[model samples]
Target: MSSTPPVPPVVEGGPAGSAPGGSQSGHAEHKFEKWQMKKIPTMWSRTWAHRGKISFGLFLAYSGVNIYYARKQQVIRDTIPQNTILHWRITDGSIVETDTDKGYFQKILRATGGDSPSPVSSLIDVITTIKRAKDDPRIVGIMANFSTANNKTQQTKTLGLAQIQELRSAIQEFKEAKAKALGGEDKVSLIAYTDSFDNQTQYYLASAFDKVYMQPSGSIPLVGLSSTVPFFKTLLGRFGIQVRAEARREYKSMVSPFTETELPPPQKQNLFDLLKGLNSQILADIAKSRQRALGSDPVEKLNHLIQVGPFMGSEAKDEGLVDGLLYKRDCGKLVESNGAFGLAHYMRVTAKEHTNKLAKTGEPSLVVGIVYLIGGIKRGGGDFGANTVVKGIREAANDPTVDAVVLRIDSGGGDVVASDTIGDAIRWCQDEKKKPVVVSFGNTSASGGYFVSTHAKAIIAQPTTITGSIGVASLRPYFTPEFFKLIGVSVEQFFTGSSDTSLLHDLEGAALTRYKRQIDATYSDFIKRVADGRKMTIEQVENVAGGRVMNGKEALKAGLVDKLGGLSYAVRLAGDYGLEVHKNAGHLSSDMEIENIVVKVFPTPKPYLQQIVESMVGDEAVDMYVRDKIHSMIMRVWTGDMMGLLHEVGLSESSFQNAPVSERILDTLDTELNPDNSDIPDTVEVDEFDEIVSGVESVKSLEHDCDIRALCIVGYTRRKSQSNNCCMRGVEDRRLRMLFEQM
Candidate 1:
């Protein structure tokens, strides 16, 4: 046992103005000494006090300078000076996370109290400057530095497969529109540039341009697509971890990554089929975009190109991948010399300047809201991928001018509860507000994503849209002694309650029965929700509810979707619905109320700190922590399934934010110690419901020990009743026998 250390005595000055180590009578000296001691803390306080003032002064000064520069830029842009070429620098990897709304800077200043302007704000200023230049006939051609703007993910996911197809279709529409706008299609010329053209998605977009240029050193990697599923079973097994999965269909390969060493035969076949279909589509698109006339031999030509070694930019030009090879500076020259005002210019001229433009534009007699649902469905109110779509719908419903809503869904779905909440919100908008809602599938909308869409009046899907996955799956793996056996470690859990032991392991005795019942109930609820939405019986829903994949076309035939069309079709339908409402209401209009102005004021991009933190703390840890805290607080009032229980223990392999403290602590220790071995247990048990079941089991055991006299008396009474009514006695005996058999 260590003893406590002695406390030091405090030293005091004798009198005011006297030095701490000097005579007691000098007041000035004492004051000076006192001031000296308080210097650091006092200085810190003063610095903080003046810091805001200094920052404000600097901010105002900067704003004044920016205003001066902006005015100058605008004047230069507007002056119809001849040979004034506009250079639109498009740097590679320059993706815009946010757009500048009109008067955004004023809003930003009011909210953030900062001098430095944001990127989006600067971009808006640039756009405004360019718009001013648009009227100047002397500004001949617009040159974009194409080295930037390589957003592969956004190009693929955000634009989506359907959107891309629509864009391609739009080109044909645009050609007709261009002829109407420019007198003829021949007057328009499009030019595009790139550094290296390895991005297939980017190349597809580039193909829309009349001419594409690349650097001499740049190479286009136009090889066929390949997808690899990394098997982690061996690694998990080495750590004595087992992944248990129960999926309804052979093609439900999402869990195969964790449980199996390699793809099962059924899963392999499914994967191959999917790959073949996807690759075929890709090949077809490439042939169409490239204008290659290989007929049925396009794949062979593509393979031949891949077999050739190191095809440079010039070679790509020869092969028709690009029109020419040029340096970065030459793009400006090309634009000034030969570039003509094309469809891109028209888009730039007419593109909606702000999100609110839809409402403000005078052309709209009746408003139809296009609620963009494009993210994950999470529990709480902030944006989570597709859940944002629901919020958009709610906003649309409240808008008086908005008579109808179109939910543009493009997601793989997320939390079940979130999906339910979103679906309920849509239903409320429809029933309470009497608004017509339509759901439009973009790329892939399935599971929870599809669940929300079921509430719509009509559902539309593109040909390639992946729509149906009418099932829910929960994965829970138990560690037990297997983990301890590998590490040569053991744990002893002690508790007073008979049910407490169940928490440390899988449910046993009464706990198992209760757990099974909970799963059945939750599953029943899931089925019922779908049944109600789709106008099917619960049993009918279950028949298709077992995790099976279906394409958009298949879903329509199965009554999962109402129509097969693109986003434009959905929008048109929404407009039609809105028009019907307008005609019925005699063109009555109302104002829409926007919520949480304070939150919207500073619509800053997600902070880097939060992104870093999320990356470090795995989803399992966060999910477990949230679930455990919620469970402790509302144990008595809980009504969900054992599926939620799996979430509490970090056993469920789903992405959520309720991480366990144990996991966080372990992560911290692992980082700090830098040990060769991790001390965390391979598995954790999460069955808090076991307690309720144990109590039930105890009651059942007591019933079994009832006195023989009591039993005999009951039997004698039953025999007398039987004598009075033979039919009743027979019915009672049958029921009793059934009950006894079940027990």
Candidate 2:
């Protein structure tokens, strides 16, 4: 808080407002004295009468109105930002993720190293944000801001392979869409500009762009891919400590670290297979993207370039690893937009736009609720805390307005009980409510992740989505007498039952037998669920089980997923299923012609209180945060195309007769006019018919192959628009004339 006070307001007719050299005459001074004396009595009387309550109230009211509208105007301005270049920076901090609150704060404290908002590139953030930018006409291009050396927060040698792969996929999709949208003209440009490019993951991501610009004097080193794991069993033995774990199968590898000095053949084969697959995928993506950019086969070039470690900027360009060598300052000039802006500001504007749009279109738009199942699974319901995802699933299913559902799953699996609870909820939604539920995988969805998703209507995953770790294991810790003596602590156990409490201690005899049986039972159940959910045989599922993890492509071949695609593709599939349901219910036309239907997005405030307070927040940071939150909320409601979000609100063939008299007559006219259902009404009163003729005539004059009955239904249900109202008037005129002539 600052000590400074706001400047005072100007007073009328005071010396501060007057010319410097002026002086009042004696007669005029006497008049001023008389006026002041008269005003003093009234001022005192007013203060005494009401204690100045009304005066203070009026002042507050005036200030609040001004503040509120000022904020609103600022939001409006942010929404209409046009011809802007977004400078997006991907930082190490952005990619770092933690599941616990303590870890989140720890990451923030690490800021002593220097903290700036890095694009976290979490699956949804990277994929959806890039997708939004691709569709947003105002964004001309994007440049990867990878100059971390000068900044406090620095990226690690190797970025997360999963994040890099997801981002690269988004970039590729953006370019493809841009090309189609532009009709073979100049495409939406994507450029990678970095101080240095070292990590294989970083190289793979950068290679996806049209041009890769390396900072002059910077190097492209460390192009190799490898995995490292240290054996701690030897060290633990010297310390007189022991560790043990048991699994249902040999390939589980849960106890490998503590039980073996070196990886067994099976475990070694598993690790090698996963790594080989990932490395091949990275190499393939880099080659494909570079080939398109360089206009030649890049397989040989990339393979050769991989062997040469750490090339200078100029050398990298010559070797075809990079397109050019330039400084960050010059890279901005390449992909020219109408103007330049940071990506953060652009995000703020987009959120503001979404909030305003929802204020208007939210009621009518089909709700496609996206319930994100992030983090580990626990025994609570969804509230964005801990690992409660079941409640969110139930909430989406219970909403009457939701036409479809998308469950975005990103987890390595946890807590079988919680996982089963969610699975039951998903099954309930599909079996009882009959709403289509589509599951879209993110970075990881193995173990318990795959368990909860078994009952989904359709499962979709990215080509790189890590899935299918189908097996179970159990661990029991036993304390030795020496271990407690070294720690200077004593432990004791008591039992009340006659059967004994051996289950709490190290297993042996019958206790050990019971533990093994339990483990076996859980493993059997996991296998059964996979077989039933995936529509595979028990033998086939067993072949893929045993704690084996595979990427989406491999999982699809194993029948673990119905299809291999991203969230957007799954969303469209859900929408298709929803549309079919509405059609079957007679809410939509089987053959209704669709032309242009313009809807106003970016709505104004519909709530009375929100209007007063939303624009009044004095802090810019607070405003931006709130605005972005609003956008995130809207995006969750439905993340599909606008047309897919429209559901019938008023008249349908089944309900037309129950509608208002005017709507019923309009529906009759529509049915009579269409050849598909051209049966007209049998009985009509001529006098009543004449009265309705005038209404129909006005609608027929509109230059649209307008559905008059539909217009009449919407008139009673939806808010009126000037253009639509005018067309409605024209339709009434034409319809009446045509009806009278036919009579």
Residues 302-394 of candidate 2 have per-residue lDDT tens digits of 666667776888787777778888887788778564456666566656655656776766533455667667677776423332223554565
Best by TM-score: 2
lDDT of 2 at 438: 86
lDDT of 2 at 665: 47
lDDT of 1 by residue, 1-743 (tens): 99998755434645454445555446678888898889978998898899999899999999999999999986654333454444443422221212322333434432463332222222212333344344444443344445534433222112345554554454444445444555665544445677776555556556655567888898776665456999887887777676555554555566788888898887687557654555555556666656653345656566576567346887887777777888877865765654233223333443433334544753344456665555566775343433344546656775656767777677777777888877887897889788888888877788778878776788998656776666655555556577888889988876676642343365566865665565566556766777777898877766656555566666777778888777666766776766666567765443422211100211223333333333446434534443444345333422342234334433342321232432333233333222465432222122211122222223222323332222222222233343453222222222222222232
Worst 10 residues of 1 by lDDT: 594-603
Assess the local accuracy of residue 447 in candidate 1 as a C-alpha lDDT between 0 and 100: 78
